[model samples]
Target: MNQELLKLDQVSKTFRNDKGHAIQAVKEVSFRVMRGHSIGIVGESGCGKSTLARLITGLTPLDAGEILLEGNRICGLSGKAQRQVYRQIQMVFQDPYSAISPRMPVGTFLTEGLVHFGMISRKEAGKEAERLLQMVDLEPQLSQRLPHQLSGGQLQRVVIARAISIHPKLVILDEATSALDVSVQEQILELLVRLQKEYALTYLFIGHDLAVVRSITEEILVMKNGAIVEKLPAKTLVRDAREDYTKQLLSAVFSVREFQEP
Candidate 1:
């Protein structure tokens, strides 16, 4: 039987805007992520996908809800406890340039987490960093270069290498490939698939693109207006989706594809 890796029970979050207006970013969202499974959360911008990612990663606190990682509550942890939880749950954000520091060498960025967690000594990090780069299909020598010296795809690969270097149980990718061109995006997606199989890593992929999400995940969650409007298998999304919002999203993707075709 597949084990449960993560669970969110009635998770909700509300943010106060500049004018003090309360915005319900996430509303009673509940879901389960099975070990070694890939689940995708798909919606348009402002549909609360990113907020949901933050909630899972503990970057943002929840107003009312429980986030359980391996059956332990992770919503309200602090200090050392929180840091420990973070080691098991890593995140890759939308913009690779912004996710990494401009001044840091790629190798240091890849090995910093491993060193901080005492997984490896400072002297051992260099070889391990090179190994990680190779795992991500990046040239080991590129690790000596700064972030600006690498292309967007290469930098994103580095970010991914860093996330997995510590052997995290779950990875939350929030628009991870949206910043790259189509070709680069495809390559990254393939790399993620291979990595997942190699490491038995569970993934929570958040993105606005339906096709991309479907290609990578086993199940799909459709969100609209801060709530999950539908949940269905990725293989049958178009055929199984019943929500009007989901159909609308499908229509939009189809229209865009048609427009782009010769």
Candidate 2:
């Protein structure tokens, strides 16, 4: 019995450049994320994947259509209403360093959301932060250190911990592992899989790498020029993708992998 957790109905966004040329960053995209399922959106840069994520998270205004979370309208809500809706959604960006405050201690960063949302007392936040760090397989003591003191992988783990701290219903990962080393990326992916199972989480993973996206998601959405050109099961994408654009992406990824092999 699968449940629908998030829905985007003909969602669209447009941006104007310096010359006032309209750019349809996201154009009438529609999708549904089932509860406790992982869906990946993959495309090259400037293909509107990130913009779509922003629209879902309510960070950007939509030019058309609606976004719903748990059957409730999430877009265009005001102040407290918006914050309440957003608390159900969390995002992990490509750069962990840019996602977190450099000046804030790691523990504070992890627990701030909890405290702000009244999930825990200030005194209890320390222990909760440690627990969150442990959940991500990071050292509890690392929570006391600044973001700069941790490695890229460690910082990303911290960011992930923070995102899950409030127990969001949908987690949007926008190229979350692209900035890490290959070995580190594997570790992070493993962590994500574990967390999703443990928390009964739903993921909306966005990235440019086909292989990586296939490895993590149940279904893959192929985006090109602000529209989804293909949607297919992850296991069959390499063999069954229908769109020419999707086939080209697979070819490109295969070629890159071949070139990198020993």
Candidate 3:
């Protein structure tokens, strides 16, 4: 059975120039995020990694192809229907430092998002905000602080909290943990895994860091020049990658001995 929570089929996007030129950004990309599974998309910047995330989450309209949400192709949905898609889909951006609202206190932004999505009432949102903070391993008191007042890792957690506040069906993480320290990255990754278990979140994790991606992903898609060059089970790819690009990505994460060592 197709138990996928998200699916992109023959999806492609392109930008145009004033002279009627088209610049292809994504080329015939296809993948799936199954219920409660994490799928990773890895590629360098400008490789359409972020674009694909936006397309899946309905942040932007696709130039071609279809995006399915729970077996329904909502890519063509407009107006009220599209808004409904937003409530089910959310994104955690690459730079938490800049992706979130610096002026608004963490609690304010988080609760506001929850209330806007009707996930929680104002009073309940406040309490839930604190609960979510704790889920991410942040102190409740930190909720009152501005983004600038918190560490990078803490800020990323706040971003995650805000993204998941609405209890989204699919969470698109665009290099979400790339900027944090190594140790803190582990914490955030663990928090995501825990949240996925509790919430049944279907994650589409985008990053160039294969090591970080492997830590959380069930499947991995290697992209190059705006297309998926290869797709494989994360564990199998780590052990035996078929594509050269996949090999190059894994080589950076695991040395020959590291993969073989006890």
Computed on alpha carbons, the lDDT of every model, listed in order, comes to: 0.94, 0.93, 0.84
By lDDT, is 1 or 2 better? 1
lDDT of 2 by residue, 1-262 (tens): 2999999999999999999999999989999999999999999999999999999988888999999998999998889999997789999999999988899999999999899999999999899989999999988999799989999999999999999999999999999999999999999999999999999999999999999999999999999999998999999888889889998998886455567888
Candidate 1 CA-lDDT value:
0.94
Q: State, as a TM-score between 0 and 1, how close model 3 is to the true structure.
A: 0.91
Regions more than 4 Å wrong, model 1: 254-262
Alpha-carbon runs more than 4 Å astray in model 3? 18-20, 252-262
Backbone collision count in every prediction?
0, 0, 0
- Return the lDDT, model 3, position 131: 86
- Residue 149 in candidate 3, Cα distance off native in Å: 0.8
Clashing pairs in 3: none
Name every residue pair that clashes in candidate 2: none
Q: Candidate 2: global Cα-lDDT? A: 0.93
Work out the TM-score per prediction.
0.97, 0.96, 0.91
lDDT of 3 by residue, 83-117 (tens): 88888888898788787667988888777777876
Worst 10 residues of 3 by lDDT: 250-259
